[model samples]
Target chain A: MALSDVYDFYRRMEDENVILSFKGEFTSELLTSILHIMETKMVTMGISPKMKKRVFNVLVECFQNLYHHIEATGDSPKQIALQKSALIMVIHENEKIIVRTGNYIPSNGIEKLKERLSFVNGLTEEKLRELYQNRLLKNKLSSKGTAGLGLIDIARKSKNKLGFEFIEINENTSFFCLDVVIE
Target chain B: MEILLLEGSAKTPEINFNQDTGVLELRGRSIPENSIEFFKPLNDWVDIYGSSPKETTQIEVRLEYFNTSSSKCILDLFKRLEQLDGNSTEVKVNWYFEKDDEDMEEAGVDYEAIVDLPFKIIEVEEI
Candidate 1:
């Protein structure tokens, strides 16, 4: 990257009020450090405990979702590259906090993910709670160590609809982006 | 039965389950990457405790922050508590949340709705 391009990127992030951003491997230790930084930032900004908890809960899921879903497969060059392919950003938009995550996913799984996101987005607050409870009670954790409640929990905590996109990167992998807004 | 004691870390919560006294206390943050793995022992303890529980069992939950996986494991733990014979064992849950933490309070309320046992939502200055 050239100095001029780097300057433009820095200016763009500043203009967008990007409080925190990361691109690379999503490890549990890294998530803990990110949460630590955000907790300090919220406290320094004098955010109320209620607001801070909401942001904290949603942020935890955002990174954990990335950590669990970003499958590295084997030690191929492509798989190694996938380790650094993920991105997460915490931005301040108006009075709300917007958390965005982007990562490469197998193209075959896009339909299932799209369905899940759309189903979560189509519900009202009351319905979302109902769905969350139902899933909590009925589902068992998969072999991948997920109860599949991350999306529902994000929507419930934020009390807003989930926004997402599936962009085709190739025949085998596609870029998936999730947008969560905390008011 | 022996006391089940586990220290809390950044990802796991502190667990102190006394089988003889039937006073189970879980405190601190529970954001484990794999909640089921961490909570299995507690759940198993509850299963064993249910066979011969105290006349009045008291369970205190003081979690500051928990992830979605831990949320489910918490429910599973409570569900196991519900299985004790109500006639012989009186199980009560005291859920504590700090001031200004409405999400935690609401989470307590949600758990209250699901479990069959009597649950108390307690407000505290800090956890």
Candidate 2:
């Protein structure tokens, strides 16, 4: 990338009040480091203890979603599963914090994800709480035990409808973008 | 029997379960990428503790932050405690949050609503 291009990118991020942004391989260790970084940033910014905790909690759910849903590549079955070049941004908009994640997903999975997103976005706060409790009690965690728990948790914490977009990358893949706003 | 003691990590919580006093404490941050793997042992210990529980069981949760996965696992641990014979084993959960951490307090309330056991949301001076 040219220096001018890099400067333009930074300017855009600054305009968005992006406190933290990352575009790279998503690993477990990276997630830990990102949380630490975010915590320190929030503390330095003098965010209220309660709001900082809320932002941190929402970020955790977002990072986990990126880790679990980002499509893995390679033909070898023994290869390590890692998300290559996922993007995450924590932006302060007005008095709210917006947690955004962008990653590629298999085309086959996009429909189900869209349905889940729309379902979560359609509910009121009371309904969201009800659904979270119901899922916690009844839903079975898949082999990894993720099983949409993160989504429900995110919805409950944000207390706002989820926003998402699907950008087609190819015949078999699309870039899934999710945004959570915490007031 | 033996006590369960696990040190806290950057991404996991410290678990201290006393077989004698029946005071199980979880402290620190819990954002492990795979929380189920980290919490399975804690959940299993609760199973054993339930079978031969103390008269009064106090579980203290002092987490600064926990991911969605750990949230589910924590609930599982609490659900296990709920299975203990209420007449014989009395379970009380004290959830501690930093002062003014309304989100954490609300989280405790949510957990209280989900589990049948007694849960108290306590505010600490600082994390």
Candidate 3:
């Protein structure tokens, strides 16, 4: 809204070590803007080529998940607006790049999210590998409807455990926060 | 059969496959929103192409990034090609990696270990 407000918000983001943050309508236009900004930042930082590509891949997957998979309802207009103002922060901490995405989740989805995470977390690296391979062999190439493997892939790529929390908002909704750190 | 040439997005790869030329090329990042949907047509196209049996098929893959799921689809594609090659059809995979990207180089080697196809690992400079 105000010039000073925008400036202060950006300053606060920077002060908080947020390298990147997006808070706008998540339309195709907005998605392109985010991708362009990320590419420019990676180029400017002179990040390793592989890391640059990896970051781009992660961005694409995360945005797609948010756009198509997240459950929405009649009251989702407010949630969508909040998502437009949602925080996607990339912070540098402990010699790792931490990408934090925050958004609201329907109360009912919390259990499924937790269940998926627990199932993945319980696996040994070898077991995870085996599971991935088994899925590959058994699944057809046409069945791609949120197999709950995106987070698992994230964990595998980062080689770190996932950090998440559920902030209760109301009886029917909660704010879900996921923090993934890539070393 | 016609060739399909689609540019890669942040989530997919640039594909260049021609039924006539038999020079299939896939380059760029691959972490598609729906791995199966994105790769299904490619796999189906490859299956059809394999039936025709090209005299020589060169598949050049220059992927900078791909998720674990994509890795599986890639393996499946390669295995299909390897099977078609059994009929004396010459097939070669030119797997390219950035000079400093050991992960990609090793991935090429891994695929080679599993498939009985002629695969070559080519190191290229960062673009």
Per TM-score, the best of the predicted structures is 1
Task: Give the clash total for candidate 3.
Answer: 1
Can you write out model 1's per-residue Cα lDDT over A5-69, one digit (the tens) per residue? Answer: 99899999999999999998888899889989988998887877887888888988988888887
TM-score of chain B of 3: 0.94
For model 2, state the Cα shift of residue A165 in Å.
1.4
Fnat: each model in turn: 0.64, 0.55, 0.31
Model 3: docking quality category? acceptable
At residue B31, give the lDDT of candidate 2.
83
- For residues B59-98, what per-residue lDDT tens digits would candidate 2 score against the true structure? 9999888876777788888888888849578999999988
Residue lDDT tens for model 2, A75-153 = 6653224335689989987888899998878788988989988888888878877787777777666556474678877
Q: Go through the candidates in order and give the C-alpha RMSD of each one to the true structure.
A: 1.9, 2.6, 3.5
Residue pairs in clash, model 3: A24-A84
What DockQ score does model 3 reach against the true complex?
0.39
Chain A TM-scores for all candidates read 0.93, 0.89, 0.81
Q: Which residue pairs clash within candidate 2?
A: none
lDDT of 3 by residue, B1-127 (tens): 8787888875679999987888889988776555777778888898888878579999999888776557777888888888888675788999999988766786687688777898999999962
